[model samples]
Target: MSLVSKFATVGGATLISRIFGFGREMLMASALGVGPVADAFNLAFRFPNLFRRLFAEGAFNAAFIPLFARALEEDGEEGAKRFASEIFSTLFSVLVVLTALAMIFMPALVTTIIAPGLAVCVDDPAAGGNALSCAMRFEITVTFSRIMFPYLACMSLMAMVCGILNAYRRFFAAAAAPTLLNFILIGVISYALWIEADKATIGFLMSWGVLVAGIAQLAMVTLAMRLAGFSVALKRPRWTKGLKRLLVLAGPAALIGGITQINLFVGQAIASFKPGAVSILQYADRPYQLPLGMVGVAIGVVLLPELARSLKAGRLAEAQHTQNRSLEFALFLTVPAAVALFIIPEPIIRVIYERGAFDPSATPAVAAVLGIYALGLPAFVMMKVFSPGYFAREDTKSPMIVTLVSAGINIVLSLVLFPILAEQGIAWATTLSGWLNAVLLFLGLWRKGLWEIDGKLVKRSLLVLVSALLMGGALIAMMWELNAWLQPGDAVTTQIAAIAILVAVAMAIYFALTLLTGAADRTMVMRLVKRKRG
Candidate 1:
């Protein structure tokens, strides 16, 4: 499949996952609000998610895909399946051990990881509370997190197989696996609330739900793999030469790949302060990520296989063309979305949140985070586009180094700005860190003679902005008109209807401008359709 088409397939499925994810969060807001339970839930949730990104999305895929693709090249389907089984068995054992140890020692782990801001206020709210303070109790968050943290192990195993599946061009099952997590959590949370309304102590039920959901998630993906003809069995841990090689590549790649996520940790650590800060940032980030996750992550996943195949086939020119096109496409989609989000965060936030537990007072803090994050939107998307160049070569160290450098910048900025920006400072740190990572990667690639851009593609990328700018003007006007039409704390139906109209108008204007600026060329539109279908 072409890069665009592949991106569309994964991205379309991811878009569904993200939307369901939004619904899940909305339910969470109504159930937990920004209370201690919400804070604990946020921190506890980050534990599994952090590793899901670190091991599954970052390190495992960086190492696994290139080698898996190579096996497919040399040995075809059977050989590739065998290789994946071996990797799966080995990864499964390691994750089991890791999850066991983590659950056993989760309190200290939570204490160690949460920011002083959160942990401090979390302990004693009367005495200004500790940063890690939970609305329930510090132990409550820690205990709940222990139950849920096994998800890292489950998801890691699932992600590794998904990488193998992706190499086999089975994108839907792997991408769709995440939807199970959202749905399961949603159902679990709803039932927990319905049955135990009096002591909704949201954290207790929600945490339990996450653990059950993780199990179901692992089962779903494993079944999908079995149906796809993958086979596996338990075995003693033994590192073969291939596994060793993957370790070498994955170690740095994991570090580099985890930079974006690590930045979040830094932000979260800092955000634990000022009550509701963590939840505020989380909610604001929802809309901002709608485009990023759908486009950025989708492009990155597709680009890895696309470039790895090209490199294996000795098609350097095709690889270069693919890289350039991916970058252009990233710019085309991400830039406009960034502009729109940065300019109109409050309207978007008010539309989606600000009901039940989530109120209007929460809007600015979330909007602040959203706008700050917007500044790095293009860079974050392009980072995905560029990093695949190295992963395809089984070279993870360079990107790892680049990520460390960016992370260093993040740590520094967080300390300097945390006191000043307070809740939003953490958001600023993430934005700065993403751009830093992107810049370093681009410079490294150019210096190493890894990629070059086409002049015409650059011009085409510029046109994306022109139409986006025009659309932005129209959106600004609509948001102003809509503000008068709807109130923040209004009924869910009214808010939903207003948001629907706003999105429809913005999309219509954006689409109209795209046609005018020729952004939707016949070829690109066709490419987008196939991509979505996949």
Candidate 2:
């Protein structure tokens, strides 16, 4: 398949997943809002999600995909299967121990690391009733953390299965697997609402829902593996050459991944100090994640294996072509979405989240954060596009070094901004860090001569930016024109209609502008599609 087709395969499934995630978040906002239980739930969920990104998806895919693809090239299916089995065995054993230790030390982890902000005021009797409530929040966070910690192990195993599927070019199963998580969460929340459960009860059920989703995700991916004719059985673990090499690369990649996640952890820790800040950031976060997941994560998944195979075959030109096009494709979709978010954040947030427990008063704060997040959206997606150039060559060290520096930037700025910007400072810090990471990744690729923009890609990128700006301007004008109808107090149907009109008009303007600017061509698209099928 062409890169576009492959991206569509993965991205299309991810779009479905993101849509369901939207539903899940909408329900969560109505149920949890920025309450005490909401804070605890976000904190508890972040603990396992931190480990999941570090050990399961990001680092694991970085180290595993290139190696697995290389093994398939060198030794065929049988060889690849053996390599996968060994890695799976070792990963399963290690995660089991890790999850156990984390669960046992959940309280210490909560107090010392994850949410030190929550613990700070929890013990002061002078702080009165609020202090006691803070203490209860800490206790609740720890309890939920322990319950959800096992998901890290489950998802780690599932990541291995996903690696197997992606190595074999089976993107649907892996990409679609995340939708199961959204399904489970939405169902659980909906059921809770049906029974008119308390907020705390809903919070507990959501953590348990995570564990259940992990299991369902694993089973779904495992079945995909079996159907693809791979029997990934647990064997006695040994340090095979492939396993050793993956571990060597994975150690640094894991740190790199953890560093990326630590940026969020730091922000959350800071946000934890301000009552509802954690949940507010989360509500703002969900909308932007739709594009990030649909474009950024999908491209990252497809690019790694494609680049790895091309480089392995000494097809440097092909690798460069794929890299440039993927970057262009990423920007083409991401830039306008970012522009739209930046331009009309409050309207979007108000439409999506300002209902039920999610008060209308919270919209301005969340919208401000969302706009800041939009500033980094393209950079965030481009990081995914660029990093594959390094991973395809099995050079995880460079990205690790760049990420460490980026992490420093995040921590320093977050500290500087938090006291000044308060909750918004955390969002600003994340945006700055994202841009820094993207720049470093781009520079690294250029210096190594692994990536080149060429004339067409550069033109297309500029075209995307200009087109997005125009669309943003047009949307602004329209929103102003429709102010009476789009006002916050309008009926739900009116709000939905306003958003739909805005999106449809924005998409039309952007795509039409791209065509007019020569950023896209129907002939080229058709040819690419034909070539992919051929």
Candidate 3:
């Protein structure tokens, strides 16, 4: 499949998944506001998600795709299948053992990372309001972490299998697995909310839902693999040379790919000093992630295999062209998104949330963080697209070093900025660090002469930015009236109607401006559609 079509296939599925994720968080905000219970959920949830991103998405895919593609190239379809099956068996055994160990050592891990989750259980009566009174509270979340951490193992294994399928040029069902994960989480949370009347028990329900969803997600992907006639079966592990290379390459890629997550962890660590800070960051980051997940991640996920195949065929120029186009698209789409978030965060938050337990007071605080994060949205997405260039070459160490530098900046800034700027400061640090990562990668790629682009892509990108600026200006002006109409005294239905109208107006303006400015012309889009036979 062409990169554009593959991205569309994956991006469309990812959009649905992200929308569902938004709904899941909305339910969560209503159920668990920015408080101790919410903190616990974030802590327990981050536990697995942290590693899942590091392994499944980052390290595993980086190492797996190039090798898998090469296998398919040299050994034909059957040889590649066997290699995948063997890796699956080894990974499953290791993950099972690791998950078991995690169930036992949950307390120590929680204490080290998310000490704030234990607030309710700590000996100090007043500790529930403090993020750090976690001395004894870690024990409470251990059970939840135990249930949830296993989800990482399941997801990591699934990611490996998915990488195999993608290498074989199967994108639909595998990309759709996350949609299943989102659906399962939504269902579990909905059921939990339906049954639970007590506030405290809500956390338990959410945690349980997360555990069930992980299993469901694993099943969904495995079943898809089965139907594709490539289901991985259990086999014994051997110290194979190929596997060793993957391990060596992936170790640093995992860490490198995990820079954003690490930044998130640093935020969480700093957030440990203040109540509601973790939840605050989480809630604020939700809306912005929609575009990131839909666009940035979709491109990255699809790009790896495309680049892998190109590199396998020794089409360096073709790989460079694809990378540059992906970079341009990411920049064009995400820059506008960043501008919107930067310009009018309150209305966006208010429109989606700020109802039920999520009060008006929560709006400004969340919006502040949202604005800060949006600043680096384009760079963040571009980083996702560009990093795959190196990953496809099995040069993970370069990205790893870049990621380390970015991570260090985040850590230092989080500590320094947290007190001065409060929740948003850590967010700003993250934004700056993301751009720093992008800058380093861009320089690295250019220095290596890995990317050379034509003129049209650059023109389109500049046009996109100009259109985005105009759209942002329009939204900034329009939202003031929107906020007025959606004011507290207005009827709830009227507020909803006003929000709908504002959203319509903003989108129409952006699209119209995009057309006029030649940001997304029909001709360019059509060219993207016409598959360039590699």
Candidate 4:
């Protein structure tokens, strides 16, 4: 299959998952709003999610895929399976211990890292609010976190299996697995709402749903692995040469892979000082995550394996072209997405989240956060594109160093800005830090002569930006023209239709401009589609 076609397979699945994710978030917004229970649930989920991203998706995949590809190239499927089994046994043992300890110390983890602000509000009289309420929220967060912590083990194992699948060019099951989480959550929330459950009850139900979803996701991917004629048997964990090397690379790749999550961790910690801030930022995050997951994630997943195979086969030019095209594809989609979000964040947020307990008053804050996040959207995607260049070469250290610097900057900025602009400040800090990470990754690849900016890429990138801006301008005019129909008080169907019209118009303009100006390669896209069909 062609590279773009592979990307489409993953991207298409991710798009479905993200759509369901939107449904989950929208339900949560109605059920919990930005209240204390919402804060508690979001904080609790973020805790395990943070670790899941760092260990499972980020570090494990970055360190594992290249080595797996090499094993397949050199020693065939048997060698790869042996390597995977060893790592699986070791990872399972470590995760068991980690999850056990984490649950045992759940309160400390909640108070210290997950939501320190809640702890302070509870203990410090000077901080002065409802201490009883704060303590309750704190306990709820701890309980919810403990319930969801086991999810980390499930997802981490799933990610390893998915890495194996991706290396084998089996993208659908892995890409589609995330939808199970959203599906389960949507059902849980729907039931909670149907029964008129209170906020605390809803939160508990959702946490348990997360654990169940993780298990389901793992089972789905594992079944896919077996069906693909690959299996990793349980074995005694050992310190083999391959295991030692994976650990060495994974340690650095953890930091490099989870930079975005790390920044979110920092932002969440800081935002916890204020009630509703965490939920607000999260609500804002969902809209942008759609594009990032569909485009950036698909590119990252597809590109890393492609680059590894190319480089392993001693095809430097093919690797370069892969990186360049991935970058082009990421920017082409994300730049326009960023433009749309920046232009119409309020309408989007309102349509998605303004009903039920989600007050109309909260729209402006969420919209502001979404707009700032939109500014960083392309950077986030670019980081995904460029980091694969380093990882495919089995060099995780360079990106690790870059990620650390970017994360540090994010910390400093968040600390400085949160006091001033509230959640929007955290949004800005994340955006700036993201751009820095993307730029450094690209420069690192270029300096090492691993990647070169071809003229086509350069030209196409500028034109993509121009097309996106033109779309943004048209959106601005449309918003003004349709102000009455897009209002919060308008009928839900009317508001949705208005947003839909705006999006349809925006897509039409952006695609037309890209096609007419040659920013997007129509012939290449057509050939990819035909090849996939063939």
Give the poorly placed runs of model 1, Cα more than 4 Å off. 118-127, 130-135, 196-200, 489-494, 526-534
Score every model by TM-score.
0.93, 0.97, 0.93, 0.98
- Sum up the clashes in candidate 3: 1
Cα distance off (Å), candidate 2, residue 143: 1.0
Candidate 4 weakest lDDT stretch, 10 residues: 125-134
lDDT of 3 by residue, 1-534 (tens): 566678778888888888988888888888777776777778778878889888777887788888888878899778787777777777888898988888887777776665543444354656544435464235446766777888898789878877877776777767777776667667766776788655457777777777777777778777777787776667888778777878898889888777778888779767866767888999988898888888887887889888888888888888888987788778767887788778867766776676666777888899899999999888888888888889998898888899999999998998899999888988999999999999999899889988786786889888888888888788767777677686766776777787678667877887777777777756755575574632
Task: Give the Å error, residue 274, model 4.
Answer: 0.4
All candidates' lDDT scores?
0.79, 0.87, 0.79, 0.92
Point out where model 3 deviates above 4 Å. 116-137, 524-534
Candidate 2, after superposition: displacement of residue 157 in Å?
Answer: 0.7
Measured by lDDT, the strongest candidate is 4
Ranking by lDDT: 4, 2, 3, 1
- Model 4 misplaced stretches (Cα beyond 4 Å): 526-534
lDDT of 1: 0.79
Location of the lowest summed lDDT over 10 successive residues in candidate 2:
123-132
Clashes of 1: 22
TM-score leader: 4
